[model samples]
Target: TKMDKHNLTVLNEFILMGITDRPELQAPLFGLFLIVYMISVVGNMGIIILTKMDSKLQTPMYFFLRHLAITDLGYSTVVGPKMLVNFVVDENTISYYFCATQLAFFTVFITSELFILSAMSYDRSVAMCNPLLYTVIMSQRTCWMLVAIPYLYRTIVSLLITIKIFNLCFCGYSVIRHFYCDGLPLVSLLCSNTHEIELIILILAAFDFILSLLIVLVSYLLILAAILRMNSAEGRHKAFSTCGSHLTVVVVFYGTLSFMYLQPKSSHSFDTDKMASIFYTLVIPVLNPLIYSLRNKDVKYALHRTLGALCNIFSQSSVYHVFH
Candidate 1:
């Protein structure tokens, strides 16, 4: 046990080779990522704020949406800034503890997103299939529990995976071939056999993925059946409108993640994997707010109201200053 601890202590720092090494690409890449990150933060934050200020949005759907926005904000924030800094800087060195921390938080947030999306799907299903009982079934207490379960499950799973990975000796190489600390890159550096750890990660990831996927699948299937049963065309259209944005986000998010993690590890390509990572880590966060706001009329109305109120406040402040 003492000897194992000593091995892990020897590897204190790891150098990260980011998405690109070309000096010419660095400036453009930095600017692009910076802009994307800013937009993502503002947009997701706006969603959360709109939900809070508008009573019309005080429903289970919006409740789940607010958390989804928060999760996207956090997920991107965890990785984007680090990637931007690494893009501009020379040495992208991260301490073992720091790497572990990044992996831990990233794990929690990413897995949380999956579970939250699943919960949102269930919410949509209830609204469609059992419209009369939707509010009672998805009460405030139930909504809180839906939000809580994912974070609790992922945090515990991440802790176990992190502990297991850190125990193995990283003797050969100290360089990770990615912008941030990810499991596969870190595992590649291990001097010991990683079959056990890989198997553990695979199982955990599968459980998270499959469990959430089943929920989404089942929810949408029920939702589709309900829509088919509706006699009026307008009734079916109204039902689909409520879930269109969520379904779009679900497709994009799950599509990328399934491509990334669900396949055999032997199929992985570092460069290709990094590109896929960018979509989820950078592109998706920016897309989420745009997707939700653009598709949902209620969110657009809320945003307009929020912006109009801010303008009025500013106009009042200006008048007061002039009089003073």
Candidate 2:
């Protein structure tokens, strides 16, 4: 909405009371977001480190799992640190160039993550549905390709879109409500016409969402049928259990995704909108490592061994020092 030839009128300034403006709120919010961000970093990075260190974890499945952890870290790095600093800083303003950079990274990593998750589901499906063929089909070469596809694809697409968005002239309404450079919301502020870009975005989002969803759906459907065919109830139960948590993660990812981008852009709600952002941006990355690691016995053993070894080393050093 243009207010004047020289100015772009903000219809809703969803004023995010930055730390400098609300001195009373700064301490509390800063402490809160900081803790959440740290937990996300630790949980995701723990998976990455554990997967790399444990020889038993060096399978195609864990290979993708490590990439998934990497993506979550990528996701958090884009949103978390910036918001944390903003909570305590005097001025919360990010420059146009920095904002654009943030926007590009956010899009690239998110698209990559979604693609990786979809590939993971397919991997699980193949393993469960056709155990004999899993190794032959999901070979090292194939697994590596699955990882590389998203990184390359999203890098190209996001770069193109970011260039399109930032090239448009701004009409002076520069305050972004929620933290980060949300592509559509940020694009809405342009002085030039943005309908073309939005349609392109809609097409791009639809491509990412539907393609990933289709792969996931197909994978699960096959897995479910295979699980049902298992002769013993216990066998079936174990098979389904392996994928259940991953399925949960996928549902949450797509559900929040549909709310954020699937809905007509015309119907914008600030509070609900922010909530949807939380789904992919903050919550998904944090939940993924926990979900994959929690019930799986192997992951637990690996983590336990890693911690136990560290403790034993400390105890041995103490004994050596006492003798000395």
> Local distance difference test, per candidate?
0.90, 0.82
lDDT (tens digit, per residue) of candidate 1 on 24-105: 9999999999999999999999999999899899999999999999999988998998889898789988888989989988
Clashing residue pairs, backbone N/CA/C < 3 A, model 2? none
What TM-score should be assigned to candidate 1?
A: 0.95
Give the Cα error of residue 198 in candidate 2, in Å: 0.9
lDDT of candidate 2? 0.82
Q: How do all models score by TM-score? A: 0.95, 0.92
- Expressed as tens digits, the lDDT of each residue in 1-324 for candidate 2 is 444656654333222333245578778878877877788899989999999999889898889889988988997898888877887666576766777788899998888888888998999999997799989999999999998988999999999999998777765666666767788778767778889998888899889889988999899899988888889999988887888878888888888888877666578765577777866787788888889899677899999999999999999999999999
Cα RMSD, each candidate: 2.8, 3.2
